[model samples]
Target chain A: MEPERFRELLDAYGGEEQRWPAEHRQAMRALYTGDSGARADVQRARELDLLLDSYRVKAPDLTQRIIDRVAPTGLGRFFAWLQPTVPAQWWRPATAFALPLLLGVALGLSDGSSGASTTVIDWELQEQALLSVTNEEPWYE
Target chain B: MQRDEENELVRRITRGDRAAFAVLVGQHQRALTNYTRRMLTDTDLADDVVQETFLRLWTQAARYDAGTARLTTWLHNIAHNLCIDSFRRSSRISFSDDADSTLESDDAPDSAEHSRERSDAVRQAVASLPERQRSALILCHYQGLSNRDAAEILDVSVDALESLLARARRRLKQLLEEFHGA
Candidate 1:
């Protein structure tokens, strides 16, 4: 590769710290070893790339609210459900989960001490329902 | 199972199969989690984003047309949207909150001792880049994706991705020159 083009390739793929895909390595290696100027440029690019790659920052874990916010939610999904024509079957289950989720929220907000009580009730109810379902269909059976 | 399994799982999800949705979640959660962490920086936020990302996958699985892109690309698209939003929200909290991250893994390969200073300089250079260029570099270099793939994921023209990287590299070189000198 010519010097300018070689420089570009290094910019694109030369860093060890930069995650070079396996398929690109042979081509990158070939370019790196092809000529002296090219080799020097590639070496520098690799060093910079690797160095940047080393300064790792993990994006914080997303909150459930954000996820719930992004995807069509109980109300958002409900509005979609309310369209003139009847909707698909899958939507009903989503709404089933969504409506209660919304109600749970509203209920939580309204009562002065509702937040703690509601969560406990919701948890217990879910536990009993889960236990009942599991009893109905044993894993080993 | 691999692609075939993913395809099957996708089909089942389309038919409203929650179990298949769970399987797909298990398969992709790790990557999505990692991607979220890289973009958001807060472990808690990353968890929420991952959860939300999967929930999106569950809901939108029915609409996923394989012809548009691979499962991975599609997932990255969802994650990217979330990442950008989070960055926007968090931008208010930290004015200079640019990339000065610690190493996530001990197994992070050998960069020499002096490598840390160079890396910091390069990171500062990278932080000075425009968002798109910074993202392109992160996706292409740090994530180790191909130019074509990174371009597609960035939803930019290939030439645009190249130009972005070119400018980014030039600026980085300039920044490092001054840093090294000083």
Candidate 2:
């Protein structure tokens, strides 16, 4: 690599060879090893890296704080417990079909024409009766 | 944490599994706190932002799509947003005084006072960077995120993210050099 390109890589990736892009690592390492000027560039980058390393922050008891803040409560907790244990793949499809299944069962139970076993003939008869009522002569006449 | 394990924990968290959430908190708290601190330059504010980030994770767990990004990246994105909010709030207040108070209390260990002084200088230099550059460095250099992930968190292209990193490092080098010379 040219000197300018080498400096740009060092600035972008820092002194650490491991942090450099994998494709450029072998060439960069060879260049750094074979050239004195490249070694100086690495040294400069290393100094900056060391300076950057000093900006550490300590996290004390933060886990408990976060837990307390996000802990589920009341109805949230109850619903969480009530959540099904079924695998998502199975439960999702089942849940998707559940409403329609319930509606069909409910319609069947509410049907008075043939008790709980209403047939297509029963539905047709009910439709005919409704039409006959509408078609009757007007009471005013 | 392994990707599969984290993904499983996220699923459990969506189900309101406190234990799973706690595990995730334990796993990422340090990195998140460090990132926030670097971004905001206040330990207390960083902790607050980190706390809010986890809380958001709990409340929005169902929104997490592992197919789009890793858990760490998602967490960083949340924390980054919180940090931005905090910055806006701080901007409304007297930031100079608050920063001074925070820096005063942020003293390092007494035994290493000299190193601590150097550290403080470096910290000040970092804190002086613009918000985006600081975030770019925190995500890529400190939090060890890949360029693409950091860019995603910042809502910028990878090339833009690299430019931010380059400018940040250049400015930091200049600041450190001036500090050392002084």
User: Which candidate's DockQ is highest?
Assistant: 2
lDDT of 2 by residue, A50-105 (tens): 77776565556678766765546646643332333222224644665697999988
Instruction: Grade the docking of candidate 2.
Output: incorrect
Clashes of each: 29, 0
Candidate 1, CAPRI quality class derived from DockQ: incorrect
The lDDT values for all models are 0.62, 0.76
Candidate 1, residues B9-80, lDDT tens digits: the string is 888766656567666666666667766655554556666666656666766777777777778778877777
Q: Report clash pairs, candidate 2.
A: none
Query: lDDT of candidate 1?
Result: 0.62
Q: TM-score of the B chain in model 2?
A: 0.87
| Top TM-score hit | 2
Q: What DockQ, between 0 and 1, does each candidate earn?
A: 0.15, 0.18
- DockQ computed for model 2 against the true two-chain complex using alpha carbons: 0.18
